[model samples]
Target: MSNNSNTALGILAGAAIGALAGILFAPDKGSNTRRKIAEQAAATQESLKENALDLKERVSETVAVQKENLGTRVENLVSDVSYKTEDVITTLEAKLKELKAKNKQLQKS
Candidate 1:
């Protein structure tokens, strides 16, 4: 995008220079040449404004997508941890019951 913008700027600069040179060399009236230059400058300004808006929108969309992806990743990680914790708790409960049963048998003996 940067490269494209640079190329666009270079093209606009060249066009402005070429137009100025042509007007200077022509036999047209001084007022007419100045008017033409102003028109050209206004047109260039509008073009730059449009390009800036487009670049801004693209950046905004990219950020939104990244944010959504990050949310999804965090949710998945939480779910995985929850499942692992449940499994660990279940195993510990089973071991505890077995140990209790063994202790009761020793008391009976």
Candidate 2:
């Protein structure tokens, strides 16, 4: 599990323990205690939903940034390879020309 998951679980456990302690120590009647517990649960649910949405957005943004970085790296690598290939071709052409000139001179002699 992720750190976020662990944090969320800890929050929920603490809330539950707090609610139980409140119900046990309060002087209120059982019906009122139940109502308060229900209210607390509803609030906690809403807060958890908001936190989950925030986490999702953060993960999405991180993925987008990483994807853009990978694309830039790939483009740079391709450009480097293209320049190297052109250099190799030019070098081979020069060597071929030198060989042809030597052959022509030998034939004339």
Candidate 3:
């Protein structure tokens, strides 16, 4: 299973065990004990739900930040490549023009 799933399961199991132990060891009467256990379970459920929502929000935010960073990096790389290509093209054109001029001079001689 995924790490997140395992972690959630562990949390649930621990909560269950703790709740059971508390109920088993309490000196209160049956009705009171049952009510307390119910309350604890409800509270645990709410807490778990809230924590899961928070985690989901954090993950979404992290993903968005990573995507933005990746886009910026890619744009920079493209700009650098374009600049180098233009420089190479300009150098090649200059060499070709010089060679053509020298060939013409040789033909006239």
Candidate 4:
């Protein structure tokens, strides 16, 4: 979960830094350089926004998948427990019947 977000953040930071360095080092008139810097900033901001949204979507998808898996596991466990309980009840009933028959035979004797 954190891993994906971390990678994206690192990439975005690196790109922003590299772009800034390139723009600063280029030879140009002051006004033109400032304009270029503003444009680059706006572009970087948009890219960051997009990456953030993508990260959110990926996290949501991962959570949904895990939730579904958890639900399935719980259902399976409940079904298994229900079957085992039935078997235990059947066994106990048979034992009770045997005890009753033995008691009757002893009373007659």
TM-score of each: 0.76, 0.80, 0.78, 0.89
Weakest ten-residue segment in model 1 by summed lDDT: 15-24
Best by lDDT: 4
Q: Return the TM-score for candidate 4, rounded to 2 decimals.
A: 0.89
lDDT on C-alpha atoms for all candidate structures: 0.88, 0.87, 0.87, 0.91
**Candidate 3, 57: how far from true, in Å?**
1.1
Clashing pairs in 4: none
Steric collisions counted per model:
0, 0, 0, 0
Better of 3 and 4 by TM-score: 4
Taking the tens digit of each residue's C-alpha lDDT, what string does model 3 give over 3-89? 876697688879888987988798989999889888888887887888778778878898999999999999999999999999999
- Candidate 4 lDDT at 5 equals 77
Error of 3 at 62 (Å): 0.9
Q: RMSD in angstroms, candidate 3?
A: 3.1
Worst 10 residues of 4 by lDDT: 1-10
- Superposing all C-alpha atoms, what RMSD in Å does each candidate have to the true structure? 2.5, 2.4, 3.1, 1.5
Rank by TM-score (best first): 4, 2, 3, 1
Clashing pairs in 3: none
